[model samples]
Target: MKRSRNEHNSSQEEQEFLRESKLVARSPQHKEKVKQPEPSMDEIKQMLRDLKKDLHEDMAQIKREIQNDIREMREDIKDTKKELQKNREEMKSMAKEITQMKEEWTREKEELHNKIKEVEDKMERMEKQKIRNNLTITGLPTNTDNEDTLEEALEKMFQTELLLKTKIRRAQKIGQDRCIVEMVEWNDKIKILQGKAKLKGKDIFIDSELTRNEQKIQKNIRDIAREEKKKGAIVKVGYQKLEVNGKKMKWDHRSQKLTEANKLKN
Candidate 1:
């Protein structure tokens, strides 16, 4: 009975040891299998914060791109505005030039109109003077000194029976040295005088016929006057004579008197 009791006790001890070994083996396996506690709210918040930081970084990058695009747009707008201003300035200049041209054209048109009117008036004056009794006499010496000399020369050249009438003084401010010879003609002696006069002299020039029929005689006279002016010669239109105190003084008489006085004083 004592051996059985000791053996039973030993058996109980072996069972206890086997239970402990099994418990030890099961503890490592259970520890490996055991689930850890869920993460704390703080840790989840940290992970979310990291994710938000990445998202914010992405958003910041997008914002930077948008800002650069906006800057480019602003630059484009500035350039467009500058171009527009330049174009406007050019247009203004062109418009000014056009206006100046128009004004110049208007002035020129007025000047042309005035010139045309002057020409028309001159033509009308010429047309009205054509119907007068015109006389033409030739064969007077080109250098005849006075109206009497010219008439005498014409009389000698044209052996016409004509009585001398009063001299008609019709001179011009400018023209050839010419005078109208007044005479009463028997038959057509005046016609003979007109047909036979030849102008001849040294240092004298005269035209056989008046330039243009008597219609443009005034214009011809003006032309002749202009020519005489260039030669420093004065043209006289009426019975003009050198005078002292308005009395007609003969050139020869004055010179002869001056010579006689000088001779006596000497």
Candidate 2:
């Protein structure tokens, strides 16, 4: 039985060996894949150097761009400053021109004003001379429309009321109760004015023919005389003058009022 068991074990081992051989025969052969070799130290250093060179080039380009931007900003600031300075200069010049023009205009205006005043004074003198030998008669009746009749009537008045012989150059009715008479002689007008008080009871009046400006001044003088008379102070109104309390008053063209004659002596 031991011999049979050994033979039986040998047959099982032989069958297992045959099965392994069949499996090895039927399977495909696999070749070994070759692997890449690891890098040496020198190769690794070279790669690192190339990467560093590329990074440095990029950094250099970025720095150059930053410098260009800074230079452009500086140029812009310089241009702005130059423009501001130019504006300031132009404004100053304009201000100077305006001041000069204003001064010249003021001077011209003053000269024009003085010239107008001078012309007015000259015209006033001419007007006063034109009416030097004229007289204005008031309180006459409008009895006739004839110029000869009016002249005859005024001649009769001079003969009867004033008791003065006067040659009437021209006599015309100016209004219902007024007439302006031009005398051939200036002394005749003076005589008629001097003898005007004689016709006070007859309701006849005589006065010198005055310019409009003189008439206004005479009116103001009479007003001042009336006020002084009311105040119990002696006042006399004559032609274009006023006398208050025995002091002569002159008309001030500048002030347009009566002022003491002595006050203007200074």
Q: Cα RMSD (Å) per model? A: 22.2, 9.6
**What is the lDDT for 212 in model 2?**
85
Instruction: Give model 1's TM-score versus the native structure.
Output: 0.35
For model 1, state the Cα shift of residue 111 in Å.
1.7
Give the number of colliding residue pairs in candidate 2.
Answer: 0
Whole-model lDDT per candidate: 0.53, 0.86
Largest lDDT belongs to which candidate? Answer: 2
How many clashing residue pairs are found in candidate 1? 4
Candidate 2 local accuracy as lDDT? 0.86
What is candidate 2's TM-score against the reference?
0.59
Superposed by TM-score, candidate 2 places the C-alpha of residue 213 at a distance from the truth, in angstroms, of: 4.0
